[model samples]
Target chain A: MTGTGRETTRGAARERGSARWEARDGARRVTEGSPGGIVLEIAGLCVDYGDGPDAVHAVVDVDLAVHRGEVIGVAGESGSGKSTLAYAATRLLRPPGIITGGDAWFYPEAGEASSRLNLLDASAETLREIRWAELAIVFQSAMHALNPVLSVEVQLTDTLAAHRPEMSAAARRERAGELLEMVGINPDRLSSFPHELSGGMRQRVMIAMALALEPQVVIMDEPTTALDVVTQREILEQVIELRDRYGFSVIFITHDLSLLLELADTIAIMYAGRLVEVGPAKRLFRSPRHPYTLGLLSSFPPLHGEVRALSGIPGSPPDLRRVPSGCPFHPRCRFSLPRCGEERPQLVAVSADGERRVACLLHDGRQSPPAELGNPDAGSVPVAPMAAWGPDGPDRSLPPLDDTALSRPEEGVTPHA
Target chain B: MSYLGRRVGFYLVTIWAAITINFLIPRLMPGNPVQLLIARLQGQGTLSTRAIHALSVAFGLETHQSLVAQYWHYWVQLFHGNLGLSVTYYPSTVVNVIATALPWTLALVGISTVIAFVIGTGIGILAAWRRGSWLEAALPISTFFTAIPYFWLGLVAVAVFGVVLGWFPLSGGLGQGMAVAFNGTFISSALYHAALPAVTIVVTSMAGWMIGMRNMMVTTLGEDYVLVAQAKGLSERRVMMTYAARNAILPSIASFALSLSFVVSGAILVEIVFSYPGIGYVLFQAVQNEDYPLMEAIFLIITLAVLVANFVADLAYVFLDPRTRQEA
Candidate 1:
């Protein structure tokens, strides 16, 4: 209801060709169901590390949005640049990481009359005013993220004291206590230092601090990667519960595809500094159109199924310093063709009425995709479609996915490390 | 045991060990202070054996007694506020000589040190926080002064400010024959004379603190908490001071404690250059005259001062850092 106009502007920005127009039309066809509107809209965002010709393109031509009351999970390999996208959008990226191009429009009230601010272009004073009051971030590893010297109470109340100067000290303290309680931490431990608390409790304190100002959007940069499985589950559950209570949007960045499958309403798959595919979580899980997304989904073990062998993608994430040409993932793509090697594919809609969009040549209809491409039941089916492979199609025997890709899945995500 | 309790006990044992070593040093040496005094007295006039024995007992040398008995007598005399007589100062007692000089050294070095620490650390914080500012250029220039010896710097200061400029007194703790009184005239004269040495010490020493603090601040700026503090929408000054500098200053506090302990030793070369009546100047005269009693007293005080200062630092550390407050 509120983001209808945003659709048209976003469509107008990408005036590349007829294919892009069709993609724009396809985007317009998807039904808008978000309750409020788009809380944030990022289009054609680009981030580069360093300057001049030697700069590494960390985030390239990325477009993502966080609708009000929605969870958008960004899943990727360790160097796939998912975290870079979030930091660039939030204007939290440090030196050497510069936003080369982009527009990140934030709608604080998420309605027609709500004022929109481009975070990348905002002044220092304006950015500071909007940071914790309208958007907040919970960093990875609360142990290092929290000030070891300050008490939990001081840290939680710091945001309030900074943004809301009119509030009395007593009121701030009471609100800090309420925040700790909301995160299931006892308010009596507010005076304790970070070292005095357990890792789980420290992470809970971080969550409490992030939500202290009740910001409209929260960016969790792998908040639970340092935690054990039990604590991670508990924290994630609490996050979801809090989201429901506050009705705020979350941009959850993690490498764990399995966790995102359960938590995120929509999933954006990134590979080699670009978005490969984006779709509703259930649709992406059941029928991933992009080969990279299919590989990631199959890489992790299913939650409620019999034990089975799993195979990851054949190669590691490409080095940003020397990213592969054409489709960056073509080197590891199982359904790659000659055209995929020469022609760069843009993220366009898979079908006219569907919400799914993919950036692989197979989905572009120049060649026939594998018959089992979208079938959830097709476990590790060989995908050597000759028509798509062109005249120089390989021999019948194709290299199977090997153990080299298995190690990539186990590499943990450490935000800003 | 509590942390303070353990620290106190440790310091007490250290003091006892230091006092025993001070008592043994003169006895262990090839010649004795009493014999040296007797030799000087005999040169002036003939001395009888009984008179020599009387002088030795008066000085608490206890030549005829066993070493154990003399050690016991030494401890008894220490508790009675008696430290024998200073051979260099003749009739003056060692305690009186030290008391006369302690305040001058304390007032000059102690105050100058504190001023240097505050100024250096302040500049360091500003330099690191506003890197590329003109204040950052001050770092290498100031640090260059640390390479110059303090006594040499004192001489150059005297030649410039004292001789060429004629703005301040050149030497001594006070003007010639000025009585040690608490009157305004006497106090102002003393401060005027102390200005050169104090400036020299501060110029040379402040650089060390500035460099240390600046390096530490750079490291702490990269810490995750500083970034998080910035993200919390804190004002630039608040984030830089409360979060960044607050943690960076911890190591400086520990170093400050060490600096305090050495304050009693009095900047020996600078005192010599100024010809100031401080413990360092007195210690130099005692060593040259071989005034064993005076030297022993000063050494014992220096060791005990170090122990006490470290104990005070421990208390401050426990207060500042919660990690150290836990019971061991």
Candidate 2:
């Protein structure tokens, strides 16, 4: 992906300053690879379910970044904590799901660190201001996520009223109708309560409400998990279409690897609450670096290819309370080594250009990546381009990570005033 | 059929059944109201057979008519609102006796119930929203009050606040010989006498509402919509009031409507303890004196009150919750 490189970073950030979705469609190509492209950055994020020794460390020392106008899909198993990471980063985690440590910096100016808001350290008022107006989230079950007593128009207009105080009631109603239309629903159904709508329509209403304020980042947590295939695909298309048209970043989280492989620009594979691999979607699908990612890829039935016996990874997800020491995945790893059980491997660069990284001992350079994982350079399944926006090409603007950015707290991320 | 129409039909059938049962129970029992009246009057003079017959007809205890014919007459009288005469208050009709007591009961129990529900439900919402607040800490104390029999509490209140402290009147709906008019003196004296009983009912019953509402609120707080509302960055008050409590209060409303219906019956024990001259106190006197006509009238009124209240509750559910508005 050709990002808006360094020279135009300041210019691009200025041009996109608080512009509504209607005003800017031409300047939507400012996706991240360079420092100017990153919209959200998390460093050393750790989340726990409870306090003291009995606590289940749901998300541990994880680092991720979502570039402007990028779709970053997070794929993990049931207990992988992808949803927890999203909730913690957004400061939406309920009690007993505490952010023990983390630095989640939301950069409205792309990569300008000075303007970034520290999500975890912000006061409740600041967090409320940042939420919905800047960052919106689409929850898993729309039926339960919507107020049953309220009509669709009321819910949509409520969000608008809370943040868009300058908007008159008439303007808010008109915008809500427009949002429903944008999400492929008839505007006449605006007065219908949630129970009055079908499941797919309710989900579409949820999407419309989330996008009502034209937020910069929309975090979708398994939004289509309960939907049928056709409805899921339709919602997914609308989501991508909305993201493209608005130039906002999306954090799409799900357990379906095949879905993420088809949707995301960059896919992050998590296991046992830790990221096991991070790479371009096509490259990761064709040439998985981590054994867990390989296991996940093999488990999904290939849409086009010679039929093969689908071998699911041996053992269920680890009990978070009793997660095995060292590499948490070693107990179920197909390519486990004695050393794998003794020491945990950190996610590090696997490609020469630092475009892909994996947390596996085989990819640590002491030994070659196992033949079972397939050669990265060799031709594998010829998958289609990531999404309608096309593949994220060589992302060379990403700087090589050192120990500081990986495990250390970010500098200059003080709490918002 | 439409929801309102269906509910009204159902309640009509229920009322018919209740009135039929009320008619049947009195006839099924031996020794009619006229016989009991005659037995008491025998002390004044030996009544002639013709005088006995006239008394029986006046009390609607005509034995010459068949039961079916008597039932028909009962319905006819009920339609005209003729509830017969009270044996206990010999000169007054059943309707007159109830009319005198209804206002007192309605004012005392209805006001006390409404006060309890409002204060209790408000405390419940606050306690659940701020789970560990001082109000929540005080919940157990309220529960203790609820566990204590309200009549016992009323008696204790009478002993302490009425007898010892002399802060309020000890009993009755109004001061003795206070001319029960709409004048300021009568109104103020009536309120003064009602103070102790109202407090007893409010303090004891408010806890049940609070506990019920608190439990519902806790469950509702975990609903996905509540979390979504919070995530929408709305103020805490908006989330609590509109999303959480709005949904949580539904079940409480149903029960509240039921209690509102029972307000017509009054708190029997509390009224007896205070000798509060409400329907409950009158009903107690009727039963003690075996005033069958008065008892039957009061029972029918209480049953009809329940049916009407539930119908009103159904109408409210349609407004408050869209889910219930759909066709079954």
Candidate 3:
């Protein structure tokens, strides 16, 4: 209500006008006994850097629901605001990234009896209790995530000391050891400093510290991005195993759709500041609904099959500040019709079960190219051949496949060359 | 423990090298103070060749002795705490004169630096964190304090606090005829005399610390670990102090150690301007009269202070930054 009307409450808008197409994301009522035990619900969330029209629209009105014990992988190119979403949802986004509107409801307990707590409006004291205890985060960089001066023991016990004050000093320390052991690290290394460990070891240590408080939900923003392929796989296995044991939902954010394919149950592809496609990982991989998703998928040839030269998307991801007028991806969309340029597309169910949703005019059977526009088949123009759409996942540095087939899913990869 | 042992060994070698160099510098200078001492004592009158030889012997600088023998004797005398006679002060030994002035300089410079560092670093953290806020607008204006030299700032301080305000005495280490004792009045008098120079030093160096710390803190704020700390739900105060300030203060500590060593040499121009009789003022007198013993003794003390400061800073780094402990 305070801001100039640059933001819209889509969650409220949906309630007033129950448009048929708006059912794409399913019913987002956030009630206690919803389908899956949705741990976190983000609705009508709008985050802009700076103020007014010129401000960088980092995260436009968006709605996302995360279910308990499910791995939800969020994929996007670097500036697509995936990390911003993570930070803002946790109320950690610093200056410039203003959360203009909407709400993020965190269900504190797992069962149907748990009440919803609006994450965006929580007070300092409540946020402190919710942060590490209920929602832990394994950060992007091992080098910068752990305090370089403090020992691993101190960093792990700091959360315990802050929140679990009833535990004795010896009990707290023993718990720190148990946490480290659960992450497959030697408990004796607790006294070692961050710099004393290798990159892989440091990342493991970071994971250990994150699990220290047994948080209900863990947001891993490229946690394994700084390690090698072997180490990355190992760390992923560790995280998955821990999630299975604790039954905590994970929001894993990465740019490599291929990596997420192996790890996540569901994958959500983001373009500009909005999600173009969101679906179950296997189904989306088999049949992508959005042209952007197709382009990203084509960038990685399927292993154990005839290898087609990867065709890269013709243009770059849009800048959030100006975000193209209609469908954010219309400018670079291969199957874009004239209607794509004239009207914005909402996320609508494309599949029979309402499980998979896409925001492209081509799927809705409404695309009608205007005759005035040159080259009616401009949408059919071929993308770049030998498309080296190298994902911006911090860990990805793969060489071009010569003859070997590499199975990789990419969420939002722009051509590297 | 091995790392600590290595550092101790390193400091010992460095200290030895510094002592040897300090011994050579004054000896290498053009004039021999023995001749000047003889001239002053004998009133420029011609003397017999034997009398000249006797005078040299009496002053413990016999020209007939071998260079190596004299060097050996110098080391032996040094261990016994004999710094030789001061040509400028004539009767007073170099050790006694330095001892008198050393405490005053240590008290003034040490206290000023500690106060300045604390104030400056605190302000630096505040300024960088708030950045564009009105609360810290005055920090930029204070940077001019660092740009002004100590001597100039000292004179202005004297003009203001000593002359204009008439709150403190104008000059000389303490009141000209004040008693030198451990009594409360004597201590207060010394501190009062030291006030102006202390203020000048604090103002000049405090600004430097703030600017340096502010830049480092700004860079530190962007580091991934800081973001991690925030996401971990640490209180803002805890995050700023444990993560940001703890790291930002590393480089500041090194510079602080360097500044601490300079305290012994005392702020030469400031001391002269204030007419305060610290080691720096004594140094000024030594150089003016070419007093080799006094000059060499003071130089040795300064060199040792610098070496020890560097060694201490190395130890501090090991304690404050875990990255440096990797080599161990």
Please give each candidate's TM-score.
0.88, 0.92, 0.85
Best by lDDT: 2
Instruction: Assess candidate 3 and give its TM-score to the true structure.
Output: 0.85
Name the regions of candidate 3 deviating beyond 4 angstroms.
A1-35, A110-114, A303-309, A367-417, B1-6, B42-55
**Stretches of model 1 off by over 4 angstroms after superposition:** A1-33, A111-114, A306-308, A375-417
| lDDT (10s digit) by residue, model 3, range A202-272 | 88888877777766678999988888989999999998777666666789999888888878877888888
lDDT digits (tens) for residues B255-315 of candidate 3: 9999899889988888898988889899999989888889889998998898889888998
lDDT for residue A261 in candidate 2, whole number 0-100: 85
DockQ, structure candidate 2 = 0.69
Ranked by TM-score from best down, the candidates are 2, 1, 3
lDDT of 1 by residue, A116-202 (tens): 777878999999998877788888878888888888888888889999899999999998888888889889999999999998998
The native-contact fractions of the candidates, in order shown, are 0.64, 0.76, 0.76
Report model 2's chain A TM-score: 0.87
